[model samples]
Target chain A: MKPPLWQSIGFYILVGVIVLQALFPFYYAILTSLEDGQALFEVNYLPRALNLANYQAMLSGGVFGKQILNSVFVATVVVILSLFLAVTAAYALSRIRFRGRGLLLLTVLSVSMFPQIAVLSGLFEVIRYFGLFNSLWSLVFSYMIFTLPFTVWVLTTFMRNLPIEIEEAAIMDGASSFTIIRRVFLPLMWPAMVTTGLLAFIHAWNEFLFALTFLSTDSQRTVPVAIALISGRSEFEIPWGNIMAASVIVTLPLVALVLVFQRKIVSGLTAGAVKG
Target chain B: MSKTVQKSRLSRSRTRSAWLFLAPMLLTLAIVAAWPLGRTIWFSFTDASLDLMGEARFVGFRNYLEYVAWGDGEGQYYGLLADARWWRSVWNTILFAVVSVSFETVFGLIIALVLNQQFRGRGLVRAAVLIPWAIPTIVSAKMWAWMLHDQFGIINDMLQTIGLIAEPIAWTASPDTAMVAVLMVDIWKTTPFMALLILAGLQMVPGDIYEAAKLDGVPPWRVFRKITLPLIMPAVLVAVVFRALDALRVFDIVYVLTPNTDATRTMSVFARENLFDYDKFAYGSAASTLLFLVIALITITFIMATRMDLEGKRS
Candidate 1:
């Protein structure tokens, strides 16, 4: 049953290609971030020097540090808010057999597919009306349109698979719906909640258009927008080193999270897509 | 009779709680999604300027199409439908979506098949494949932009060293290669997602079937074509459709990698330009409305074509 030597070699070579293609860009980014001045201009395949000057410059700048914090706050609040709303809504959608349930689920799915630009003009007006144009709340508010639907869909799918026996027992014991959800379902739903929350956090963190459109100030911008707007005085002086450093700093945390919760992330993604 | 009454009471309470639980979510959707979408569609018909949105007068379809008559039957059309740039963006959007999604699916299938094999360090390989997907889109765009830099980029340097070309090409700046650069970056980033989705489907195909096929001396290529491909088609189709819809709305990559270039301006970018930069808010609204309609039409056709079991009847 063993494969031929040539075939095995070919397979291994393909695997090598896949691995190299996947990891090289990020690796090069890290390499570029460590190089400065003349070294950056000349492309060296290997790391010649261990330098923290770019990282030092990036962190020493007050605005980049603040932008990172801005990104963290926005993504964190978005995750927490969307999870709370989605859990309750998922309970209703999945556990209760109500009229229009199918239609309602379809609505949620379609909303997730909405082009964000479609809502930009009106949402811009809404933000202005609420006096939230320059604030992080604008992002928090607008981000719900994208985050809520998937969270609700994935959680509903997850919630529906929970055993009914426990809920039935609780119901027979004269426990309220909220009480059963609190006592019986909450513990069981943690893995799903974590997965959906992480996805939501990433979506909010990486959101660019809305963040770029709504927040005009440097200090209020998220990391994605800030990294995008990172520039020197002129086109010729575009700061590639600082830009690469900022890119690496923001991406490392996400990479770690994906690697750590690798299995959960896969299951969460499949449950959201393949199940539908 | 007492038992029946209790059951009815329980059902009633459940429905009530369902409504109560859904209330907050519905309200948020209304505020964030439904209301704004309605306004956007409405704005598409008005002469709404960014600065004079309040005093905007209703102008029916003028932003979409307006034909001004000139003497001797000579005339010119003005508006989104008549604008060559708008149509160009539409073409660009469709082309980008088709090209990116197709490549991603193919590459994704290849990667998924490779990863499906029993090998050492499979977890590490899978994680490595996921690195591109895990990176933020903007960051990846920046990374690729740096690498694809005309003069100082390593991509050009390596290509030259490898004797691929005579000179380093300006990837993001040149019109001929801008879209190619965008697609390269997009395929690199999204192929992992497609692969993961297909990998999920691959895992569902029972191993015993493959074993049985092997016992029958079925060739690996035939087994893949006849069994594996047929089995994973559903997952692959769903993933392709998702990726296509996503690609149609591609903004961040094109916007970051090649800005202000007609070669890569997508519908989302074009709409945003008019909305803010061009001071043609209503015109932008019309463009966005068209984009929505295109996506909506595709989504509806897909749902109907697949006859998706929205009620979970299959489950």
Candidate 2:
């Protein structure tokens, strides 16, 4: 059942267009980053040079180096905290028969759907109250508002599918529920944990509004904010090449994660979303 | 008797641990999400400004009046209701959401359909499209901004080369094309998300149904309309609702690409300005509360519709 020749050609052309639309921006960014100074002003489809000076300059100068470190530290802490809380709660909801579990899970899902702006002012108050303003801990605290619900939901879905016999066997051996979860269940839940953790990491990595609001100083800014506020020394200058360089550097890890764990990422997304 | 006693102990401890396990997470959420949300609602009723945080006196309906409408008679209205910029932002948000979500759905369906077919290099193409989704929104906005630069942007160059425009257009700078520029970036970044969701939906359709339709010698479009569309409608609806909700609160792309422009300011951006820049905390809270209500209404409607659809399917 091959398509007609013309239709096949058309299909390929459409596919080509989709791919180009998806990749062109980043591709163009790379091309721009490679061109320094006067080369950036020209509209070139292909790379005219392969210069690493912008990347070198971004890393060597200013606080971008610290910003990348802050992003990593914050994102890592978020993933750890979110996975820890979500796993325990997911266990309670999934394995232990409990009243109001369904309603509770639905509530958790709805919390993730909250628009960030809706919580901004109050969150600002909360951050100020905790004395966490301009600190990485503020991001760690604020990101949970989003990361927890999603991890909890996805992990609950995963835990619900595991066989009951293992837990029962552990119980027959007089093992505690906590013991069973730590020793037996955690071993089986690695794939789910990995998928959920990675998704949480990516969410924390890409979050902009919260990052932008909570942190003010150059030393406290995350990679996204750093890239956003990347400006030239002069008021009129934008320094496009340096911005593109920083963008590529920040995006490489995310692209690698997506490529390597493509299937797991997709499953985690559908599991978290479709179940809603 | 011993077995039953052991089982009882296990059940009791399990309940205890369950509560124990849920406590920290629930407390964290209460402090982080629920409490802040409650405070936002409370703040909406006051005249709190950032400069005088603790001095906020309860001014019943004052903030609301100023946010919505507060003026003497003689056809005078002040507040957001009187503010043309606020209305323009609201319009821009709705327009952006509706148009972008509609296009994303159509393109997502087409992309999903294409990707659903068994073909060579499918995996490569799938991975390629995900690049946009993986990049940060700010990064993508910056990238698109460069590409849409009036004087030196490649997009303008290509358009000019192709004779689509007689001159290089200042896309983000011009009010007429600002919304269009934002939509292009949003649609580009988000269509992959819609496609992935719709692809998941497409995978759920049983092959036998399609086989039966084909056996009847149904035209392809008829098969698609009758079988594919109906079966995938729920997933598509879910994707649409999600995208629409997201679009309604869109801040990053718009804020990054077309900052300070009335033509592209969204509800979120409008609220943020009052809260942060203008130091009108209570006014911002009112705007935020309104935004929250709008999102909540849409979500409730979606949930009700989904529930009814499920019950209808059951019947």
Candidate 3:
């Protein structure tokens, strides 16, 4: 039976409210970022003036450039390092009949669940001991604790789904194991590789506590920490226009990536969490 | 004899290949992940201080004993039972997880349902809603913090314009509203992710069943309750469980959005404060151990409940 007209209206209104609620912050931020100097505090519903000073100032901040670089460097390194090991490791767990495959996965899964806070104190000592604290490399190394397990787990999930006969065929061609993985299997598994890579990339980029704790100076800061801690010269104020501009600038890339690869991103992120 | 020799050689090579492939990952895990985890657990039982790391002493079961209350002298020895902060942190952590996850699941399901329909500009809308999820948690939290400021925020302006409130509220500063404010920011940032996951699950269900139900003169609500719910139940449950686990580990959003007030601090935040700010390395490790156990227990329960056969469920 068709619902009454009022019910339809109610449903539409409810959904409209939801979409509006979801979109409101972005709209508000964009509106504020566009306004002329000090106009953000005067008007709240919409922009009163059109200007780009906030964006310019945000880009000009001494912290902004280095923080962006740190985030990019850390996320990129973690992706390369984790994926390099994950691919080979996943092949072993999926293809080879190993004695300790189960134990290894179990260990990874257990380690993955460990709250970073639990490991922070000890990792602090370790990081300082290695003289790597306040360095971007420490953040890269710490992020493996976040990404490596999932890379192996999900890639292993993906690899096991690949046809065993293909590998058998490669073996018949006198291909070395490393050669087979590098040439034959890798090309086929690229999508899954990218899927896991994107997840790992985002995790590293979004990491905050380690970056906040491990880095003290603006030169070493990541974007998230820099964005979180930026204060005005005085206690009575916050820099709203610039903060909004910074958030929008940082978020655009991620939003674009997610929108482009919605299916892969969805599957990659939820894969481990779902089957936990 | 040549054939048999080749076979033996192939088997020997196979063993070598397997070991070679396993070597890099195993070594990394052993050094990077495994040893650190072991070291953390060990450090938890010892009276270790961050600054005074050289003066560590082994105190087996003392950390565990702290939380274990009984008629015995465990309270005096462990001190966890004596300290109300630990218990409060646990309660606060559970509350944050439960409340935020529940809200996210409901809101996500609604959003997923909306996106599942065939309509114009659907792609644009779906992508747009995910903007918050794409932003780093720190950025999103800061963005929301500005939007919720007491005096000059758009939220208060809109609320006042709509006559929803009598006065502006100190969202992050007040203990009364701080947790709720944090939860709101978290919900905003994570709901789209939940929606996307649920949407993925929604798309997997066969539409023919609903079409057939319609031919049978089934009402919309009945079709949804009978056909859609049962079919999508497993995926939805999985998504919800995943979300719950994620929420339980929420630290960044809370830590960034609000001051470390007692009411707003999740267990992870509390543990971090203990470790870094207070120099209580053992205590922080203890808190982390408990948090790990909580997450592990949830994971185990989910696995058992779902009865997942990952090898079989290739899709």
Q: Could you tell me the TM-score of chain B in model 2? A: 0.91
Model 3 CAPRI quality: medium
The DockQ for candidate 1, computed on C-alphas, is 0.86
In candidate 2, residue B254 scores what lDDT?
92
- For model 3, how does the per-residue alpha-carbon lDDT over A1-276 read when each residue is reduced to its tens digit? 676999768767766776687777877788888875567777557566778998889888666976788789999999999999889888877777656656666766666766677667767777888889889988887888878888989888878878888888888889888988898789999889899999898888888988888887888888888888878988466787788888888777787798898768877877776544
lDDT of 1 at B269: 99
In model 3, where do residues sit more than 4 Å from their true spots? A1-16, A273-276, B1-12, B61-78, B310-315
What tens digits encode model 1's per-residue C-alpha lDDT throughout A158-214?
A: 888877786988988999888878899999999999999988988898999999999
Docking class of 1: high
Per-residue CA lDDT of model 3 for B181-215, tens digit only, reads 99899888889888887877788888898789878
Model 2 stretches astray by more than 4 angstroms: A233-236, B1-9, B66-76, B308-315
Clashing pairs in 3: none
TM-score of chain B of 1: 0.98
lDDT of 2 by residue, A11-103 (tens): 899999988888889999999999998888988988889999999999997688899899999999999999999989999988887666667
lDDT of 2 by residue, B282-309 (tens): 9888888889989999988877677622
lDDT of 3 at B265: 86
- Per-prediction TM-score to the true structure, in the order listed: 0.99, 0.95, 0.92
